[model samples]
Target: MTTTCLVVMGVSGSGKSTVARELADRLGWQMAEADEFHPEANIAKMRAGTPLTDDDREPWLRKLRDWITEHDEHGEDTVVACSALKRRYRDLLRESTARVRFVHLSGTGQVIGDRLAERSDHFMPPGLLGSQFDALEPLADDEDGTAVDVSGTPEQITDTALRALGLQEDAR
Candidate 1:
């Protein structure tokens, strides 16, 4: 198989990490958490209840792009969970690698807030959810991606994404 990568993207509290982790395990691919690539400054901003500006996020996005390129050159199948909330962010990813496709997780702000509150530990607070929605530019319908509803169980969500990406169980 060619080196392909799937970007599992969504706003905070949308289960991006959980779904992406399971998907990577099932697909036997290298999993990259976009959060891990964030510079300490960005993490501090979120922790302080301040949403990151586009300028603040640009470097982080570049890091993700560079990682994708490096891993692609190594012929590894990869999955990344990123809050690529804008068209421009997605464009940067496209420019970095030709093998990337996105799976966007979407859910109601209330649902996301509940999830965030229930979670034990995460930098992003529920207070940032409104800001996230304010800045979010949902993936366009014509975009080459899968839009999965995240209102159900994480397992069900992962199965949908796996089927959408054609990731098979045996690959794990």
Candidate 2:
């Protein structure tokens, strides 16, 4: 059977995790958090309010890609929260055997920054939000994905994603 992987992607504080979790629960699909794939050095850099270079993110992205491929091999549909800020990174992820599509959580800097300022549980510092936006390359028309505004509640965002990705009927 064919499987589909939904990659919930965006800059930091864009609500990727929240939306992805809701989508995964509603769709009853396997889920993974991209941050879990980060190396300790990457986590430490972010905790220090330092932005990671492409080199620092390569291994992390590869791990995520591998995760997708592994799930695909098992014919399990999946949802993952990843900050695939660059087209190149998304390209690597698209190599999966599963139909890997993206759901980009988009929001203005002011909005996301405000949300980030209120968070204290994550290793990523609010100060790095700017760097995430700077590195982001919005999905091109050719890419199999849709961009959803992150200004809404998590449920609302997930609803939009389900409809946009044609997965509404799969919602449980």
Q: Candidate 1 — number of clashing residue pairs?
A: 0
Q: Roughly what TM-score does model 2 have, to 2 decimal places?
A: 0.98
Q: Model 2: per-residue lDDT, tens digit, 1-172?
A: 7699999999888888888899999999999999999999999999998899999999899999899999999989999999999999999999888899999999999999999999989999988888898899999999999999988889999999889989999999
The CA lDDT at 38 in model 2 is: 97
TM-score of each model, paired residue for residue: 0.93, 0.98
**lDDT measured at residue 126 in model 2 versus the true structure, 0 to 100:** 89
Candidate 1, after superposition: displacement of residue 112 in Å?
0.9
Model 2 segments beyond 4 Å from truth? none
Clashing pairs in 1: none
* Number of the predicted model whose lDDT against the real structure is largest: 2
After TM-score superposition, the amount by which residue 54's alpha carbon in candidate 2 deviates from its true location, in angstroms, is 0.8
Look at candidate 2 and tell me the lDDT of residue 146. 97
- lDDT comparing candidate 1 with the true structure: 0.86
Q: Return the lDDT, model 1, position 65.
A: 87
